[model samples]
Target chain A: MYSKELLKGTIEIIILKLLVENGSMYGYEITQQVKNLTKGKIVISEGALYPTLHKLEAIGVLSTEIIHIGRRQRKYYHVSEVGKDISALKMQELSSFLHSLNQILDFKLSS
Target chain B: MYSKELLKGTIEIIILKLLVENGSMYGYEITQQVKNLTKGKIVISEGALYPTLHKLEAIGVLSTEIIHIGRRQRKYYHVSEVGKDISALKMQELSSFLHSLNQILDFKLSS
Candidate 1:
């Protein structure tokens, strides 16, 4: 498991990109998909996940839809048009930041 | 330039790794080294830099040496034994986090 401190900064970008790729996802679905994709190497806790989702929605980068499956209501989140642009921008920033970090860490570039 | 939000989480790891690689460095020198290393792609600002340094010192991961260069005094920082171990741990965490992030970002793995 990764430390919370290590995971703190990148959570927003992770959520943004996941929404971009998946089109839309509910909170539990997002968590499950992350586990599926990373093979359980990373997990997003409810405490961290919900607040970030709400925060992104508050920032206008995400919009939610209420879906009724049987009697339960699930909030599904999708990127807004603005959210798509923000995801692209944030992805670029994440790419560059990781590049710089790799260089600093002296990790052998696979290329 | 990356957003402050993007840079916030990684700064500590960056500082710790630089100290590990360079042995010891002063604040100005560390900032310059980061610019030199990343070729100005990332700049560590004074406002963000000092408090982190002081925080790391308080946390026992860093120790300082005061040196006089002509008329000026400079505090040089080096990793404590604990800091070195922390650097290694943080670097590993960083590597894994980046890998997971890339998978989420759909960045083509160079491998």
Candidate 2:
């Protein structure tokens, strides 16, 4: 399981990347996808997930569609073309961070 | 300059990493370091920088000290030991992101 404190930054990237891979999905579906992919290791609470999703959508990185599914209206989020481009850069930025992290971790482990 | 929309997630990592490199610094210093390091390409505004700093400190990743400098007191933030470890992980996480980003960008460019 990821640390809640650390997870705030990670969640946004996961949301964007998931939308890039999946055409569109609603909040519950996104929540489930994360849970299932992590083998239930990461359980996303509604409080943390919804606000981040809402903020991302508000910022135009994601576009939402309201669809009637069964007895209720569900909002599905899809990545905008701009979101895809940003995702690409975000992915690169993360890789850079990982390299630095590994170096620091290894150095610490050795010392 | 980076996109404000894309910057929210990035700023946290930048703040942590800067603290890791430089022992302790205040809000203005953090902003200046970012600007100077980027050769003024990236300017961190008061709105974005202070909130993130406070949030990180609140989360225990950063510990702040109020030093009397000049005519007033300035709060200087240093990474907690935990923050350093997290920073290391964050660096590695970013590296992983960059690799994925490069792959996506290259594929897009070629296609």
Candidate 3:
């Protein structure tokens, strides 16, 4: 598990990207997907996950659908049209940032 | 330049890694180094950089030395023994996080 401080800024980007790719996903499903995809290297806690989801929804970047899943209704989140635009923009920003970061780290490591 | 929000979580790690590799560096030098190393992809703003440096110093992870050069005194920052330890730990955490992030993003992009 990574430090919360280290995870703070990237969470929204991750969620946005995941939604853009995977369509609608509920909170637990998002957490599990992250874990499975990362092979257990990353785990999003309920504390951090829900607040981000809520915040994204509140900010008009995400829309929620309550679906009946067996015993209860579960809230599934999908990227809004605005969210899709934001996701594309954020992904580009993230890609460039990560590229620069990799360059910095590789230069430092090689030198 | 990336959004300040995108840069928030990763700044300290970048500084720590740079200091660990480059020995001691002053503010402007660090800024310039990042720019040069990243080929201008990443620029550390004074507004964001100094507060992080001060926070790290206050927390005992960094130590400062004031050196007089050409009648002007410049404060140079170096990782202390404790700072070195923290840097190593933070680097490991950052590496894992980035690895996981890449996995997620790559999967999304490929699928």
Candidate 4:
């Protein structure tokens, strides 16, 4: 497991990307997919995940739908039209930041 | 420029690596070196740089030397033995974290 510091500021983007990939996902599903995608290397805690989802919603980058799963309603999240553009920008920033980091770390570039 | 969130928690290691690479470097020199290395893509400001340097020094991950250049004296920073071990762990954590991030972002992995 990596330090919490390492995961800071990044969970939101990952959450956004997963929703885009899976079409739409509920809270638990988002957390589960993140774990599966990274092979359990990155786990999103409940404390961390909800706030990110809510923040994205507040910023209008995400929209949600309430689905009835038996008796309980699950909140499913999906990217808004704004989110696609935002995701593109955020992903670019993240990608560029990683490239800058790689240069400092002297790691060979992949993309 | 990338978001400050992206650069958070990684600056110390960069400073550590820079000192390690150069044997030792004064604060101002360190900032200049980073600017040069990242081609100004990553600029370490004095506010951000000094605190990180001081924290590492306090943690025994860094040690300092005072040297004279003309009439002025400058404090040069270098990694301590403890720093090497810490540096190794931090670098490994950062590297692994980046890899995990790449997997999520679906970016091509380099290292």
Candidate 5:
């Protein structure tokens, strides 16, 4: 697993992007999806996951629905229109950052 | 400027790698090198730079030399043996992360 510090800046963006792309997901599902997608290299603990979800919800970037199944409540999250916009900007920013990083690390950064 | 959050995980490794590759650099030089390499998209302020250098020095991943030019004292930093090993691991981890992220965001992660 990568350090929490390394993962901190990205969790929110990853969650936002996944929700925007996948339509809707519960917290546990998001964690599972991230794990599965990253092939277990990146694990999202519940401790780090819910707070980000809540923050996104608080900021009007996400909307949630609670479903009751067998006396257990599972909250499902979806990105709002605002979230879609934010996700696009975030994806662009991440891409740009990573591209700059790639040049610095793997290619010639000096023109 | 990219958010500090996005840059937090990267600065230390970037500094270490640059110092390893370029021999040694002072704090201000590291900041300016990052700016020039990223084409001003990513800026590392002195406030963010020194503490990280100090932390690396404290951890023995870096060694510092004080060079006196006129009345001014400049501290130049170089990566130690341990830092080179650490830099390799960090670079690999970061590459793995960005690869997984690329798959998730730009390709199919459902395979």
Candidate 6:
């Protein structure tokens, strides 16, 4: 698992980016995708993941549909139109922040 | 204000980075620092910031000291030893993510 301290901040980004890439997926699927992508290095716990999904949906960044598969009702999440634009902007802002950080870390590398 | 979708993911990083830069600060000070740094473009509501802080401290990534200043007791947060190392790693991971995103975004720009 990744560091809790670090992962706390970026879990939403990971969820959003995953939805952007995958179209739509259920909660378990989302958690599984993160785990598979990270090779089990990052596990998004159900406790943490569910609340985040609920929060994102509450904010209108994500819209969900409930589907009944057998006995289980699964809620699938997808990005809203606004969520897509917000994702792009967030990617840009994160890029800028990373650039600044690289400058700090790579100061000696370039010289 | 920054996009809610985007800021949601990076708020923890922002808080951690601020603590790393400034040593230690109280909740209000941390909120003010974020607001000032973003030119009031990113406001961390007490509703949000307090929980994030409490969660971080709960996980042992942060340690808090309660200090009485005049009329109120303020809890100040600082990075733990583990938090500092985790911060460094998260910075690296985020940097790597930004690099990949730039490559995708800039591919069209470069062409």
- The per-model DockQ list reads 0.47, 0.08, 0.42, 0.62, 0.37, 0.09
Q: Please, what are the lDDT tens digits per residue for candidate 1 over residues B1-111?
A: 776667766889899988998899999998998888888888999999999999999999999999998999999999999989988988887677667766677664342
Stretches off by above 4 angstroms in model 2 are A1-111, B107-111
Could you give candidate 5's per-residue lDDT for residues A1-111 as a string of tens digits?
A: 775677767888889888988899999999999889879888888888999999999999999999998999999999999889998998788767777776567732222
lDDT of 5 by residue, B1-111 (tens): 776688878887788778988999998888889889889988878887899999999999999999999999999999889888988888888767767666567732221
How far in Å is the alpha carbon of B27 misplaced in model 1? 1.1
- Looking at model 2, give its docking quality level: incorrect
Model 3 chain A poorest ten-residue lDDT run: A102-111
- Enumerate residue pairs that collide in model 4: none
Highest DockQ: give the candidate number.
Answer: 4
Candidate 4 chain B: 10-residue stretch with minimal lDDT: B102-111
Model 3 TM-score, 2 decimals: 0.83
**Could you tell me every candidate's TM-score relative to the true structure?**
0.87, 0.51, 0.83, 0.94, 0.91, 0.53
| DockQ-better candidate, 3 vs 4 | 4
Query: Which CAPRI tier for candidate 3?
Result: acceptable
For candidate 4, lDDT tens digit of each residue in A32-65? 8778878999999999999888999999999999
- Can you write out model 3's per-residue Cα lDDT over B1-111, one digit (the tens) per residue? 786676667888899889998899999899999999888889999998999999999999999999999999899999999999988888877777777777777622221
- Expressed as tens digits, the lDDT of each residue in A2-94 for candidate 1 is 766667667888888888888989999999988887888889999989999999999999999999999999999999999899889877887
Best by lDDT: 4
Once model 1 is optimally superposed onto the true structure by TM-score, how far is the C-alpha of residue B28 displaced, in angstroms?
1.1
Across A1-111, the per-residue lDDT of candidate 6 in tens digits comes to: 333544544567778888888899998998887666655667778888889899989989999999998998989899999999987776666545434333333321111
Which whole-number lDDT from 0 to 100 does residue A53 have in model 6? 90
- Sorted into a CAPRI-style docking class, model 5 comes out as acceptable
Clashes found in each candidate (C-alpha, N, C closer than 3 A): 0, 24, 0, 0, 0, 1
Expressed as tens digits, the lDDT of each residue in B1-111 for candidate 4 is: 678888888888899888878888999998888788778888888999999889889989999999998999999999999899889889888887777777778886464
Q: Considering just chain B, what TM-score does every model have?
A: 0.93, 0.89, 0.90, 0.93, 0.91, 0.88
**Model 4 chain A weakest lDDT span, ten residues long:** A102-111
lDDT of 2 by residue, B4-110 (tens): 44454567777887788879889998888776666665667899889889998999999999999788989999999998898888766654443333332222212
